[model samples]
Target chain A: MKSVVVNNISKRYGSKKAVTTALRGISFEVDKGELFGIIGPDGAGKTSLFRILTTLLLAEEGTATVDGLDVVKAYKAIRQRVGYMPGRFSLYQDLTVKENLDFFATIFNTSVEENYDLIKDIYSQIEPFKDRKAGKLSGGMKQKLALSCALIHRPSVLFLDEPTTGVDAVSRKEFWEMLRKLKEQQITILVSTPYMDEASLCDKVALIQSGKILSIDTPEGVVRSFGKKIIAVKSSNMLNLLADLKKTELLEDAYPFGEYHHAVLKNESNEHELKNYLQQKGYPFEIKGTDPNIEDCFMALMKN
Target chain B: MRTLKFLLQKEFRQIFRDPSILRIIFIMPVIQLIVLPWAADYEIKNIKLAVIDHDRSDYSRSLTNKITASGYFILTDYTSSFEQTLGEIEHDKADIILEIPASFEKDLVKESESKLFMAVNAINGVKAGLGSSYLRSIIQDYNREVRTEWIQFPRFSPETSIEVTNSNWFNPSMNYKVFMVPGILVLLLTMVGSNLTAINIVKEKEIGTIEQINVTPVKKFHFILGKLIPFWVLGLLVFTIGFGIAWIVYGIYPAGSFLTIYLFAAVYLLAVLGLGLLISTYANNQQQAMLISFFLMMIFVLMGGLYTSIDSMPGWAQAITKANPVSYFIEVIRMVVLKGSGLADIKYQLLTILGFAVLLNGWAVVNYHKRS
Candidate 1:
């Protein structure tokens, strides 16, 4: 059974004349107990889509349901069954860590004892500071507490909007580990992030940009969709290398990727000719064909 | 019911944990209740009198003595030059200048009537009005003394005056504190109940916690109740403290039973808190909530007839007071505290406030949407 089903969902902001289209015919589905991700940059309708699925916002067109319940009509029942952590820190700052968790538990008419086993892995990390106010916690600790609170009710479907946006690198890895552990408990998780690297951690990701989805597939499947050779090239002057590569009619696109510029060659451009042309320009460089990652695919999709 | 209990628990925890809220709850009552009543005394006194005694005669001296002895005028300056006394008025050394013209004794003895010129600095209109009236009454008393001394026994005076003896019932001493304490209590209740609940929900909105709560299974009715009950109880707690202060400090124990006051306060709190929640629904942040609350509270308190009389207000203002919930509570509190009015006497006001409670909370609940 599908945990979430969104069909042709569209939303617009502002008045009639100066309308900003935030979502355009957004449609997707999350299978039961699957870890789903809506991957995009900022203002790519990621938050708007999350809000629509969580029933906090209404779409101008189409329908969405969580756990087989209509987001609009059965919002009350959906609210009871789904846990949503908004993009921003939404817990009471003045409340202590344990108090925050207990408060959310009580709000859902549950007890901490009932859901302790489910959140023990995440909650145990910050359980030592249970008495400290939530606002005083470090960013990672705050995220852990928020996750614990979001999971306190043992929600059937969990929606986390940019859960790791401001977290440190280590904490972001640990948060993903926590999500992977949660997937084992049969709780379907729908998470959003602007970090392209986190896309592979999700069971499946929908690459979205400018209020539209470019593609929805597994990590490797998205890279496979690139379906073109990418030559990673680097020289002493990496700055001019990108500009030089883009100037060539032989390449589809070239962007800086760490120490090397990942250049996708046109179908007609031969790798040997490209290397020869660069050598004749008196620019000594190293070039090699490389595998595309999610970021590369995202960049390629965004270009199209 | 269980959800409401948890909600109240969280709200009260937040309230007690914040030092600023504690200060507002405790410190404000101490300052407003203890200091305001004494400072807001309306009984006009200490009129600075600059006397221009041109006659310098027995009667002028006697009039001056009587005016000074009346305890209303301070007799700031006594001089022969009217120009000098005008300087006294200009310099703010005196409030009223009493010029007794020359031949004052001779004219009064021969013609039995004489005119006296009194000039008052009209700035600070209340003081000027009250000071001049006080001086006028004292002069009239001096004239009565002069006539009684001059007339023989059993002789008919030329003028017959109708004497109006006044009786200030309920508050026989006309103590300003006694009248003010009850009104201040009502104001205290309003400030605590409305301002706290007004900012409570908006604080959640600003912190982004309201979105979390909205996504929960918590019903709108329960959420609003949870926000309201803690503050409502706190409002009544403040009221009790204010009432105790009124009794211990001002010696003002209400003539009516305490139950009547609480019963009215219970309904009054619901109305004001409902108003606060209604404002919270419209406001997106604490600043907006505070600004809107301040605006409505200003209108409510001013027109509620605390500082001024509703009857004295113009027709439009009086019409506003009729709609103002604060006015009803102020009127009800005064009735119960001063007049010993029972629940039956104030049932009309109680019902009107109940109507306000129903309307405002209903409108708030209707406007408060779980999704937008």
Candidate 2:
């Protein structure tokens, strides 16, 4: 069963064409118990789309339904069925973690004791500081508290918007692990993030840029479709090597990737030929064939 | 109902845990309730008198003594010339001037009546009016004393049957403290209730928790009601504490039923909380919420007749008071506390507050955008 369906959603701001067409005709669906990811950079309409699906915002030109209920007409019902953790840590900072959880539970006309099992994994991590004000908690603890609050009512569908954007690497890893545990409970999840690596953990991924969906598929499938022989080159003189590689006769695309330079061949040139050409140009370098990653796929999609 | 109870419990815990906000909520009201009434009095005192007595006779000296002895007027300076006294009055060094005539003693002895020239600054109408009344009363007393002492009896004893009957309905002594304590309590509760809740919700919006709440199954009305319930109870708690303080420290106690007072306070408090929620819906940040709430609170307290009587104000100003929930609350509180009137006497004011509560909360729920 489809847990969520978004069709042709678009949003515009104002004159001076500050008007960013957020979610321009973006359409997608998530099956029950699937961990779906919307991967994009800043201003890619990730938050806007999440807000629309969560019933916090109304899309100018589209229809979205959660649990087969229209997001607009059935917002109240949608609210009951969906759990949302916004990008920012927005729990009551003045209240203790326990108080925040209890308050959220009560708002749903339920009690924390009634929903303890659902939030136990996330809540236990921050239970040591249950009496501490949420504002005084660490970022990771705040994230945990927020997640616990969102899950207190055991909604069938969960929406997490950039949940790990400002968290530490360890916390981010831990958060994704918790999401996996949640997935086992057969709850459909729609998670949005700007981090490309996190895309691989999702069952399916959508690569969005500038409010437009560039590609949507499994992470491995997206990388497989990159269809380019990528080479990583390194030399003592890195800057000159990058400039020289871009000017190379057989080099189709060359950009820095971390500590190495990533390049694609113009017409399927061999490594021996590339090494000989570089030697002739007096640019001593090492070259190695590398498999395309999610970042590489994103770059390839963006370039097209 | 259970949701409201839990939410209210959460709010109370939150408020108590935040030392800064808790301090502001409690300390501010106590200070304002104790100090504001003293600072807001319109009664004038300590007037500086500059007299230019051209007729420096015993009668003139006696009249001057009488003026100085009135306690309201302080004889600051004695001028020889009229110009000097006039300059003193213009410079604000003197409040009033008594000009005794040259034949003042002869006129009083020979003539049945004599007139003394008096000049007073009329810039501040209330002060000027009180000053004139004080001077006239002093002169009248002095004249009566002189007449009785010098002449055994008047040639013609006109049987002037002048009768003066005065009755003060509530607070017979007209103790300003009694009248003020209740009003200040109303003002204090309104300020703390509206400002704290307004800032609380707007802070959530700024921090992004409002979005989190928006996605939950919680109904919008439940969410808003849950948020305001805590502050509403806090307002009542503050009122009760203030009532106790007033009774113990200031010897001011409510003459009406405690239940009536609490009931009216609870209703009025809902209106205040509704106004706060309305403000929070409009404000995007904590700072904006605080500023707007403060502005509205100022207008509410001032127009609510906490400092001045609504009846004494102009018709237009009085008409505007009808829209202010604080005005109704203050009137209800005063009537219940001072006049010992029950719900029947304040039914109109209670209805006005009910209307405000509905109107404000209706606007809040309507204008509150689910998405931004």
Best by DockQ: 1
Q: Compared with the true structure, what per-residue lDDT tens digits does model 1 show for residues B1-372? A: 999999999999999999999999888887898999989989888989999988999999999999999888899999989988899889999999999989899899999988899999998899999999999999999998998899775665566868799999988988878878899889889889888998988888888998999999998889999999998899999998898888888889999999999999999999999999999999998899989989988898889998899999999989889899999988988888999999999999999999999999999999998888
DockQ (Cα-based) for each candidate: 0.88, 0.63
Q: What is the lDDT of residue B312 in candidate 2?
A: 95
In lDDT terms, which candidate is top? 1
* Candidate 2 segments exceeding 4 Å error: A13-20, A102-124, A235-253, A268-289, B81-92, B97-125, B143-152, B155-167, B369-372
**Candidate 2 CAPRI level:** medium
TM-score of chain A of each: 0.98, 0.95
Looking at model 2 chain A, report the run of 10 residues with the lowest lDDT sum.
Answer: A12-21
Clashing pairs in 1: none
A79-190: candidate 1 lDDT, tens digit per residue: 9999899889989999999999999999999999999999999999999999999999999999999999999999999999999998899999999999999999999999
**Each prediction's whole-model lDDT (CA):** 0.91, 0.85
Say which candidate scores most in TM-score. Answer: 1
List model 2 lDDT by residue over B122-181, tens digit each: 887887889888888889999998888787776766776677999998999887888788
